[model samples]
Target: MVWGLRLFPRAGGVDELALDRALSAVDGPVRAAFALQLLEGLDESGVRELLAEAAVADPVGAMRRAARLGRPDRAGAQAMLRSGEFDPCTVQTRPSDLLRRRHRVRAAAVAAALCVVAGGLAVAVEQGARGGGEERSPAGVFAPVLDPAELMRTAAERWADTSRVDFTAWPARGGRTDDDGLLGRALRAWAEPSESVRVSTTPGTASVPPAEPPQLLFADEVDGAAVVLFHDSADRVVRYAEPLSGAGGAAIDFARTDDADVTTGAAVVVSRTADGARFLLAPWIAESTTRDLLAPDTPGRPLEVGPDGVTAEVPRPGAGGACETWPVLQLRSSERIVEKHAFLLTDLGELAPTHLTYMPKPGRGTPARQPREATGPDALVAWARTACSLRTLAGSGVRSVNNWAFAEQKLPEGGASADWVCTRADTWRGPGRVLVQFLAPAASPADPATVIADRDDTALCSKFGQHVLAGTHWRADSGRWYVLGAGSRAVTGIRATGEVRGAAGGPTLAVRAPRDADVELTASLREGGTLTAVH
Candidate 1:
């Protein structure tokens, strides 16, 4: 009926389409609040309480936002409520009628029992006449045609001689392999996962199914739950898990793997087991160590890795908290590289684990010469923790991330200079993108950086790229206005001509110009080339 109203409606002159548009303009929580209050006829407090149960941060605020958008027609809603009215009390019944109905039900049950007994006797006599009658084993009567043991042996042999460090080479672990139902379910999930199944692949990893059946990686029990890990293809890692007691539906998850993961030397998939969270390490991982990225100087804590490449239960980070401690995994791969991975337990959603990799401006630096050295600059690590990069790019198949300080300019009226940084996320497939941030001078190390722009594909911060960062006015302490312009790192000097007469060298230019003037700026690069600004 509610959908009918939406499809064709003029309820007290309220256009349901317009009302829907207004509600859709708000966030999800706010939209939910509207549905509960208006359609479900819930009170404001009840709606707020339900929203709180759903983990909404500001349930009352959501309700307030819904109310402010204007309410629909109460009279029309009341009329709809009246339209479906029915009274149970209007029907009549008697004890005499109930007794007759009970008698009829009892007679039907006896007749069914008699018919079953006669049919069984006839079947027994027929079997006796044919040959020696024998009862079949009930346990094996409906066994599945596929053998779990045979399946495992075949999959294992397929990858025994392979040189790749993928799921095929990974040892099969998990105590639940004997459970044919669980194994079959996992295999079916791999071939054709349900639409509701959650899938997360890092930027460059493949998300599609393999051309053939996936190879088994692990089929053992982890902390009381049956977990089956496999690979859809060489580059795709898939995991399926369910309760050992068969109490809940199975959950299937997918992640991509590549040479970058191998070169970094270790990849991990964070899975939620029955007891807690467990880190599922790749086959090539020799050892797993973790440390608090928030406290970089702290000594690493080694986690015991089982023969099956599963780590003991690790503490799960609280979702949405101002990250108190960023957990960094130093997974030592068989190739002897300490791969750094940082996990963020964000409120956004479940994400496939991505490593914290650093790419220095090609010739500027290498990925840390020391085995114990951290991946990127200290400032970049700080930015990753405080800024929204991790939260935003968690599902972008980010193979690695590098923070580049593109340009820095001393504020015209400030005590310190502001840094313009571009954070590039190199995905698996090939091309990468960047996030541009205008980090104001920090009074302390704890100050958070602000994101100025996030460009999906741009060469604005790369080497040999030529583009002016378009000028913006900054007001001084004494109320004087100055126009500031910055260019790429290759830019050697900047000249402001019309309405602003100033020249400055080294990427940044500042001139005391009118706020609304038609300013013309030109940038000179080290390659003896000059280019005019275009915004």
Candidate 2:
């Protein structure tokens, strides 16, 4: 199926290959009529009229004869008819007009080919399009296609016209889908003239040179945010770059390198916040392969430093030398301090690395705090409760009884009791200092949840590595408490009755009970911690 179009097979007839060959043998006008009837959804009268105007007699009959000769079966014929290459609207002119248009298209194609030939004659061309080389067209004598310079210029014009832009390192590998929410904010800031916005381009910084000739790069800056886009001669986006926010820093200097280097790679994002400069070195490997490298106790000690402002280095963890060790830099001073840093091994390849750094405005600085370890059951429970509360606020519910909340609550020991129960438990941790888990009903299950929050609130959860819950609701049967919700990060707040407040300045949670209801709140604290009831 091409572009979601499928053709049916004929019974005991020639295969698609034979049908294609036969179709190629037909006259151009007859083929055009067939395409119009099949692909463009044109009526028989329309096809006949167009063919008559072109002085082609028995146009419908001729198409039928061609189909029969090709033996394409109904399906194969349909595939040929539906091919996007032919458009019936363009064929509505007189026969002479049609011929002239075709000639013009072919001439344009030939001119492009001649330009490529001229470029080739001047110097040795690389395997792929690079260094002033012309890109050869696979389709000969067809239509005009944009060169790399034209594509870049068009993209830059488009970028300047829009307030928002998204950049991804590996667009073809689904990296484009991972929106970090910074692009929107940057766009908004750019709309205001008072805001600091810069637009420029960097040469030879992309991880992978364009696979096609005429690679182009465009860069834009909004305040402290920076965005870079890489395009090929065909105007296709090959890579994107943007700075990310990091803890203890004004902005994170980071870039996604193409897999052309090593299979496993490391990334260091340096971001500046109001507090100070923050650096985060994370492994760009896959989650399953990051167990050892991202372990909580894994040592991230600096390997080396130099006079060129380079501070530390972490070797790739895998056995192969197919990976490059990334350096994690730390900046420390007496008054201002760097907050936290981490590194992990990840699975990613393709796209070259482009480095970027955004320094916070000199006078705009806030006091920095030392990073603290959030260990113990209290901390775990706090994290779990915050996660659950966010889930509840967002309207998400429990999916299965085999979740962390159920195990932590010891609900299985109750022998399938029908009592309403709520549990919050820890789940997993990301490469950085972020932890993830779930909270839900210990008995009655509900549908997947959704969160309703404004953009800024939603961004909070994303920056902190928290997946918000949505569709969460509180229901009570007898004196038992039951909460239902789903998993997501779009949750903003809960619209429920009661005074909801954040615990330890975390996510806001609230629960209301009837006057006579016996309410109990407890936590399993670890060493040097205490569980207290807030009455």
Candidate 3:
């Protein structure tokens, strides 16, 4: 709350005395009512969430209002009340419900009441959702609510050790990045580890600073591994390096839809691949491009993100192509777009992200109008599927990116730890299964038995079973398959299911493979089923 005094000062009126009075009565419905008045200083979504989640006493009534009037709008809520649902004076619910809807509204009842009593004074908690633009001083800024990307990144770093980093120095040309979004941020923590990783548009470079500067967003280590924050003018990483982590860190990656001009300031972008790939580790600055990335015929500027959540104009991608605005996700090995649902990372510190359904799609999308922030990965996936009419088989971008599925034993995974990544079309038609057992684990002593594979439905047989070990059965069905016997422990981590429909006959589908292994799939249709192997 460094810049708190400046950013939050009662947006409507409460000029100090009016504020203090409200601080005393914070709690229950009265507290929420006051907090509602003070919400003007907060982000739009944060306010909406507060009303939706908080126990307003008449929850069922409020929900009815929400259904009829949409949400929080007094007119709508009043209209809904006509149907005999609520009274802001009596909106209440169970404590357990508070837990379930915590993300919606979990403001301290006491604090909210006090703030309201103080006129329109916003409590500090009310101003918690600020992102970028509003702050004048670095200290004055508030970290945007814990977004899905940052939270996931933190989790990934913790479980897989991507956080262990070195802050020996900052790169000369490195600095804060403008390329940022609800997904994640990029920063350069130290001097480029090697000269080969260095680059400069002006053709000359210099040594970076050596100090624990405030500008450095964060620096940490996990399992002895290191990651440093890079900025446009202050980071030490001299050049962007490939293979950010030798082997262990290959699993962690970052991306967002960057269909904008890459030529100037910061912009968020999703990637095609991430393993050992070169990226804008820190922030930098340069000229600005006047082109929009969404135009199909537009030749856009090529820019990259910097450390302080900024972007810098750079030359075109080495292999030139029109940089169109897409809702993409980029990893070292590949990149894809958020074509389906826009999943906003939550501040709850949990893994379950929320999907915002703004457009027409399957039963999943919600037709709610929302804030204009750009889209995220979930949205892009759905979009790609619908646009391309991708079937049970892999989609175009996934095939090109060469997505893989790791062995069944991957741990602490979710956009980190180099685990198997498979983005399936939610509405695929046939049976989908990853090969549980490679056909020849004994014959070939190469790698694990798990390989990225699709079930080969050789329209012939139906009940296919093989004994991996006595009592452990590998069964395949026309629609479902089991890696272990019926009573076996659930394979929680193994990405076992995929859609499998196409002409009944077996089709060699795309799936990750353990270095060198043979995978087998079995399925049935009107023509029965058969088993087959893939290298």
Candidate 4:
């Protein structure tokens, strides 16, 4: 497996025949990851040499070959990649500052799904595109829990409607149980959730935020006319600036202009429903820009509408370097309304009135830690006696599916920054789930930012989990969070001790709940107090 090659040396211990079989069923990162085992024999010094050469290699194929064999040749490196064995369409940049940045596990996967299907496939056509972006875990936050009872559910007949088919080819979908994954594995450590009825939890009533009226955010158009609207059931929209767009009902027409970018200077219109649905209306971008719909449309039309009203796209996205959340306006042709979605426009470059972008952040930029040759985890050594959840398993199942990427980052006592490369994820298993792996970096004077790559010395999640198994070592807090898995079909958390860390360096709270109970833990090395929870 690519992972085996990255961790252990190619000296032995891997089953080449098994990997070859795996290659047939999977592609993208998983494939490339498994291919890593072949390169493991090299020492730290040898691996470093290969990365250097691979960096400046001329032919892409050469890189693939070397990366595959661990010799690190550019041609070989690209070859392994070209095999469609990995995420071919992954947005690529030098693996420079990757170690320093914190990853947004779920966000990266979502964005990758979009980029891969579009970007990767395009490359395949020419060379053909093969595959796919941020993750944010703001500090001083509480863990989130899923209250299935709260999820709206209809009769059993409604559940049956989930499929267009009457029977499934494989097993039934159920709870998660995979230790390699952050959440999948954690489920085993917690308790079971409860089966309850639906009752919307208002922030005030649930002890989340104070109560208020749910607010409308945006709406999107479907096909041509149907509009989909989004709202904050607890009126949390204004607090987070969740974008709202669909405003669907628009009949925009072109005036036989040669170019598509022209727009009229006509005034824009917006409306909202009492139930928290919003609408945005405006004359075509061409009309708003040139003040003449009849003008040439070659260059591009300006976004005559934005957040603050529509002065050349108001609400001004955001400050530089930070992620700028924007609305993805899916139009029908040059100016027709289709539907819309939220995205982060990395930069406010020259995007057309209808074009979209995503959030950006400030920084000189850090690179991801380039995963070196490694052996597959010990789990791959043995297969599960029975595949528990079809939902949790992929076409190839866990071991054969996602070939793990490994690296180590040491946040020493004094603390130094290190870079870690994170590719956007193409798929996310659990809903609203964020899997975190506590890395045990080898002792080094170099701050995290300077740690470019992982030496074979780093350990696996289970191996290094001891650091956190007792509890988070750094200063932190606790709150109501949830865990989902089958061992018990529930997840329970507790008020363990927390430490000091983050921008404020204060005691933070943490929480985990399995439908039946809530576990809250808060600790501050500085300001200490025992947390008490009543069953």
lDDT of each: 0.57, 0.30, 0.25, 0.24
Best by TM-score: 1
Deviation of model 1 at 234, angstroms = 6.3
Model 3 residue 260 CA deviation in Å: 24
Q: Cα-based RMSD of the predictions, in order? A: 10.9, 22.8, 23.8, 28.0
How many residue pairs clash in all the candidates, one count each?
A: 12, 50, 143, 143
Best model number under lDDT = 1
Sort all candidates by lDDT, best to worst. 1, 2, 3, 4
lDDT of 2 by residue, 1-535 (tens): 3332334343222454565644564557657776776667788788888877877744644554434443425665676445433323332221335446678889999999999998986556454446655554322112112222223223322322333222222221112212324322222222221223322112123223334332223333322445433334322233233444432222111122322211112222222333222222221221111212112233334333322122132222222212122221222211111123222222111122211111111121343222222222322222222322221111011111111111111122232322111222111111111112333333212211122221211122222422333222344444444332222212223232233322211122334434334333323222222232221
- Model 4 lDDT, full chain set: 0.24
RMSD of 2: 22.8
Put the candidates in TM-score order, highest first. 1, 2, 3, 4
Task: State how far residue 467 of model 2 sits from its true place (Å).
Answer: 18
lDDT of 1 by residue, 1-535 (tens): 2321222223323444455445544678877876687667899889988998998876754675566444456454334333322122333322335446678889999999999999999878867886756653222233322224435333433333455544455555555556667677666555556775544444345555455545566677766567777654466667777766866566776655555335332444546733346766766666677665555445669888876667776654433325455555666555332344333222122234544533223123333221112344554345444444454554446655555655667787656776665666656555666666566655554355655455555554444343435455666768888877776656778889887789998778888887687678888977787876534
Candidate 2 lDDT (Cα, 0 to 1): 0.30
